[model samples]
Target: MADRDWSIETLHDDYRQALRIDAVHYDSNTDLQRIRVLENARFGRFMTLDGVVQTTEGDEFIYHEMMTHVPLLAHGHATRVLIIGGGDGGIAREVLRHPSVTHVTMVEIDAGVVEFCKEHLPSLSAGAFDDPRLNLVIADGAAFMRESDAEFDVIIVDSTDPIGPGEVLFTDTFYGHAQRRLRPGGILVTQNGVPFMQGDELTNTMRAFKALFGDATCYLSTIPTYAGGPMAMGWGTDGDARHVSLETLQTRYAASGLACRYYTPEVHKAAFALPGYVARLMP
Candidate 1:
């Protein structure tokens, strides 16, 4: 089995463990359009059924921030937000950072993941686990999108890799459905995943998004957990806002007093800078 194949080969890296504690994924498969959860421990390593450690130190935020913030900032007037997956609650936590945002509806298929996050990883989720502004609905995001008439200002697809619960969210039909769920001038952002394992996956996703939305872009952010490499994202909307200048954003996005290790408007602008392989696929 591929899980055993991966198990035998996956080397231990400091990236997946903490404090003599480690996690491992014993087995994983999607059924009924949901990623099944399983947990395992090996040689002091703790792993999830998804074959990755469930840890507070995980770099899920770096990708979630870049995926959600860049587009929300670009719009500069987003109020209502929708996040698919992210039952871990990081995206919902970040979405509230924008003063412009009034509410966020997070639709995730796995109630177990949501429960675990609230119980165990409050620090990583930053107490937004039970924020009044957040509505955490445990349901399939695609079905919710189909029945959803309430349009959002921005929608962030914060799913796992395509193989598991998120396969539908990656398809052209889902993109089409997302476009329909958005307001006339709404933006969509997605965690398109590691650019290394699947060459040109970013570009291909961008191509599909472009066909659905007039404006589309792919961006990169360094995430330490995913395959020991950087992660990529896809963004699309009808119109582009004049970018918020770095100097202006410093004061605008809460306390110019604090600093972010990875996100700067300058970084946000540069994130769109793709390598030769990804850039060539753009129309």
Candidate 2:
């Protein structure tokens, strides 16, 4: 991928690759507006409900791996993992990358997204749905946290932004629930949103995260389809902050771990080094 800088502006590298062929309006489904799937010459085909490009066919691994592997490796031994709001099965694919990870329980609100992925996105999901290591549950992520007695080594909140169906997932209540759902040593991570475009919301979300988790950190990456060129991730822990060492990730995440275009070790470590504006939000 050669960095490509991964921006939202460039012509060939930008998100304006291909066009949608057909769109349907279904009310029995979701209130998320402008929901439609697209077929692209470059990106192959993808399902995008409510105008939010759920997962692009071309670069699903970039987002999914960064979201899943960073925390899993950061925690050092993430044998048991939980995913909230990632119905596409991409995060689950990355979670299973760790041989130590015995199982993953995916709590998703939209069962339709799963069906869509199973039907169209097998390449991106890489059969994570059929893996014995996964337990797919159709339920609200926040509600699942409230009732879950399971203790996970890591919890990755692969949620969309705070609005429409994905609103409650960003609340402090959900963060508190996530804390309870984790073991004492468990680490929590989430996609925080675009820093450049949704700046205030990003800061506020970090604040909500800080209130519940003992330690919290925010980071950024470039995801073209999102609001701005830069997207973000939040790292929180039930216990104190722990640094991910070189030795810890030597086995699982290497210089060129798996097939990834965007997330590199340098990018992985540098993502957490926030700017002055974003850093002020932390404790």
Candidate 3:
């Protein structure tokens, strides 16, 4: 009998993780990047873009919930939200959970990522695509931020690592444009990769954020599929949302009626407390 195929992710030069493939659900090259959907016993179904593990069914809730809920709940009232590069729809699914969010503009550079994920990884999105509040726009996220005069109370950057198509999203120019698109007191959260393995990524983004916003720091969440150590979610805003008291967060969490597996008021507060290594990386 032949050995099962393996999907190896080489995000780091010194380390790599391989998933023994139970099945090959989808594998093809989209115009923007190569997309692969593989099934594994441990992770269920996971999707990768350009050979990088984007999200997995086993622990996606951790990333999505933290990325979406922290900023929205901190802001206290975020009706209009913008999501840049979350084609897999995990972020959108989490964002729509907030009843106060009436509008969500999700811009993806690759339409193929959305279409394939809808077809292959339905569980990740649930029914976010059908949600009327979502305004799906197929365009470059950086360009959209620059061109659109529309303002958002919260903006979530659910991008892949700063490579290939996702590189531009981490630039200072893009961050500046996103800051301009934000309403006063609005929050911008970003996926800043795992700090232990990608220290430069965190440092570069924090430097850009520090220049762009009054409050610029990062929060941590551990996702197994992402490899390395704890991943950092970049937080930036002129508002005092990051300093929202624990009592306020608890009140908001209870009022939200959100049953989350990983994200709790306590976890939200603790996530922002950076370790010395991570703190040193911050500008």
Q: Which candidate leads in lDDT?
A: 3
lDDT of 1: 0.68
lDDT by residue (tens digit), candidate 1, 136-183: 888998899888888899999987666656777888888888999888
Provide the TM-score for each candidate, comma-separated: 0.80, 0.84, 0.98
Off by over 4 Å in 1: 1-49, 53-58, 242-244, 254-259
Better by lDDT, candidate 2 or 1: 2
Ranking by lDDT: 3, 2, 1
Model 3 misplaced regions, further than 4 Å: 1-4
- What C-alpha lDDT, on a 0 to 100 scale, does residue 203 get in candidate 2? 73
Cα lDDT tens digits, model 3, 137-185, are 9999999999999999999999988888899999999999999999999
Clashing residue pairs for model 3 = none
RMSD of 1: 5.2
Better model by lDDT, 2 or 3?
Answer: 3
Supply the global lDDT for candidate 3. Answer: 0.93
Please give the distance, in angstroms, between residue 266's alpha carbon in candidate 2 and its true position after superposition.
Answer: 2.6
